[model samples]
Target chain A: MIAPLVIFDLLLALTIVALAVAVLCLRDLFAMIVVFIIFGLVSALAWVRLSAPDVALAEAAIGTGVTGALLLKTLHHLRYVTGRLGQNAARGLTAMAPVPVAVLLANAAFCGLITLGLAVAFLGAPAAGPGFEGLVAQAMPQSGVEHSVTAVLLNFRAYDTLMEVVVLLAAVIAVWQIERGLSEAPAPVMGVVWQGFARLALPVIVVVGTYLLWVGAEAPGGAFQGGAMLAAVGLLLLLTRAYVPQPGHRGLARGAFVLGTAAFCAGGPSGGQRGPRGL
Target chain B: MLEGFGAILIAMGAVFFVAGTVGLLRFPDIFCRLHALTKADGLGLALIALGVALLAGTAGAAFRVALVWFFVAIASATCSHLIARYARHGAGGVP
Candidate 1:
């Protein structure tokens, strides 16, 4: 409503529109990837604006950070392969007359349907079941946890969080196996600077991660948050080739990856089902 | 008073996000595009998270949102690394 804020919002909106247009118009595949990374960041910002910090965080980490990296790598590989072997190339020939128009029409129809469905869903906000607000309030008053969501995630829905951890571990294992199947050993890049920094940073990161996990019972943190931090360390290690991920190297990575799930699963049945805590 | 600031922060974040996207689209080369995305996403999310944290009266709510913020950062960074590696190794780009 203020003039400056309104101006800011308009600018943001314009930028998003411009980027989308540019991404669609760009001829180069690499340019498209770059556009997508920008899109991820913009979306994260949008999430924050919408009063969802958690979503924003996830968007930043998973969307822009991880997904952008993945896309860029893929594009780079494609470019390299194309340059060397010239294997994959888009054909310049159109099979039939008016094919472009027909293709456009089909895409338009698909977009229309998706847009309509999303709009309709967003417009509807039916009354939910027994509200968690009441429960959360009660729990807060009695429980030791300072964070409501942390309480919900760890105490109420501990089992779900646990399983989620397992899923992450499974995914990491799959990635490792895929690379291993290709006969790629953990090619550890050697450098005193890289190794030294990693050695220093790893311990600090680990300590922070552990603090997050341990404080979850009564703080604004938990396993999911902690696990992600821990995973980041592995990711960093992998990046510099500090800790080479070999074919069977499944000790710390494996444990950290699955710790949340293991904890959750172990808590369930043994602690008796109290409420809903599914991931 | 705080509510007004929250609104301002949120709006500013959105602008950055859009700016990042535009940069990404306009930038030539994979690395340059990545730069746009990382900068935009990190700032945007932080602003949004800050707003949310302010709105959250309880510590738990704030924590939950913060957790999301933390995870998003980790995930995004990791993905970027993967993409870079794929390009370098699979495509034979410089490591």
Candidate 2:
């Protein structure tokens, strides 16, 4: 008999695969987005089951929460644009041509072959090897952080982390630029219940974000998780129209966007100087 | 004994969750579905959180679990309300 834990794992994996198929097959944009979000949440659970709470938190916050909201926003924009065009245009967009059976079979066969190959490769690999865990543990004292993951991310591999932050900054800037071209029609005011909830929850969200950032030195939390939490707060504010940006708010917003990259860059040289291979 | 009790509570919570899912699938309309889901799942989650907290056996862990339950309750309530409102009135206003 299969162990209960193994059965749970199998079910979770099946659910993820089913969600992926549903997301692809669902023609309705809203339904597809919802399925994708469910996929993210299920994957997050899988991560937790694999004993990777850090990844689970990140997946839940960024992959499911923020990305799902963004997709919904995109759908709203698409509807607006399509509505402006005509009903015919919207219908044309939705009425995509069905894929041929032969192509579908070919794709499935290819995917199966790839999966088989990966399974073989994984099975053929050595059961044990000198992995980075030992090296990380050896260097942990020098890294100055209790959490090995954070130590590796922020100290040993600071350059990679810095580059990631820079990329995020660039993406934010790009999005801002694109958004500037869009119509500045005021967002509809949410109901009083939502407004009240947002007001009550915003401060709590900030506190949680700060806690996540602080806990990274010793636990499964970090800048990415914290930033995603803050982003959720921003989404809430925008949804409620409680923190609408004026022309004067642009400077402050830009500064906040650049702060992470700036701090990383400033810290990089100092950290490098303390290392054995000083740059 | 506490662990066993916690396990039982968790099992009960799972039953409620199953009930909620069934209601979600079988309910006639969006509002009805939302009604079934929010009420059932909120209580289900609270029970689950309580079970986990009891299993944890630490004040700090229980507090954290309670905080998670609080946040999830707020989010679920607010989301259900918004969805029901949207279904009833549409995006712009009452049609």
Candidate 3:
């Protein structure tokens, strides 16, 4: 017999699927984006159910928080672009796209079959698998990091983690490069509420982000989690026009951007294969 | 008694979540939806966090739960404000 927790898991899984399909079906761009965020949150719940709090935390902070915010920002920008292009294009982009019925039906059927196949495979999977969890746990102490996840990512698999960080850095640099030469229009002055909120939240977010960084030695947090928290704080400041990046700091900003990757590379020789203690 | 109270708090929190989702789906406009969402979800999260904190095996675990709740609360409220502002200037439909 399934336990109450199992039932809850089933319901959570169902909710996630419902939200995902709702996001696909919703015509309103705003509603679809919001539902997509909800889907991310529910998937985070599923991660938690699987006893992976680190993934859950990352999914919430980055997957739901950053992705949703960026999507909303994109939607807003798209509206402005379409507005400039005139209403007809806006209508066509938002709601007036007329796809052939046969194509739509065929696409829907293809998606449905894929989903059914995935569901069948998921349900038929074995409950247990050969995994390196035991090996990781056994070696964790010697790996020098107190947290198993951290030990694996930064210690046992430092090369992979280092490469991942470099890839991310490169992606951000490319984005910055593409966004170069954009005119810096003056942002509107925020009224009292947003200003006050920013003043209150900025310090708290910074401290919390630092704490997450520090706690990576023993907890379900790390640079990724901390970075995402800081990104949220940055997003807030960006929205409020509170902390604008001045042109003078371009050199320092570029240096800081590469600092993490440089540090990881520098540590490779002095550190063990896994990573230096807690990295 | 304490465990019972914890369970009740969690149940209440779940109910609030349902209420918030209902409001989100049924609200007439974006502003109203944001209002319902921020308040209901915030309180619901608070209650759930408190209940989970109470059930935590250690003080540190309890503190962490509260910390997560606090972060989420501020984030939610700020996002609600931002979304409302975005909607205000005829960007998205204002409620």
**Which candidate's TM-score is highest?**
2
Q: Write the per-residue lDDT of candidate 3 for residues A71-180, one digit (tens) a residue.
A: 87666556554354346554434565579999999998999999999999989987688678889988977876688887887778888878877777777777778766
Q: Candidate 2 DockQ category?
A: medium
True contacts kept of each: 0.00, 0.39, 0.06
Superposed Cα deviation of residue B64, candidate 1 (Å): 20
Compute each candidate's TM-score over C-alphas: 0.55, 0.86, 0.79
lDDT of 2 by residue, A138-234 (tens): 9999987899888888889998977777677777777777777534544654588888888899999989987887788899987778778878888
Q: In candidate 2, what are the lDDT values of residues B9-70, reduced to their tens digit? A: 89889988999999999999998899889878988998899899999999999999999999
Pick out the ten consecutive residues of candidate 2 chain A with the lowest summed lDDT. Answer: A270-279
Against the true structure, what is every candidate's RMSD? Answer: 9.1, 5.5, 5.5
What is candidate 1's lDDT per residue for A3-28, written digit by digit as tens?
A: 89667667777877888898777766
lDDT of 3 at B47: 91
Better candidate by TM-score, 1 or 3? 3
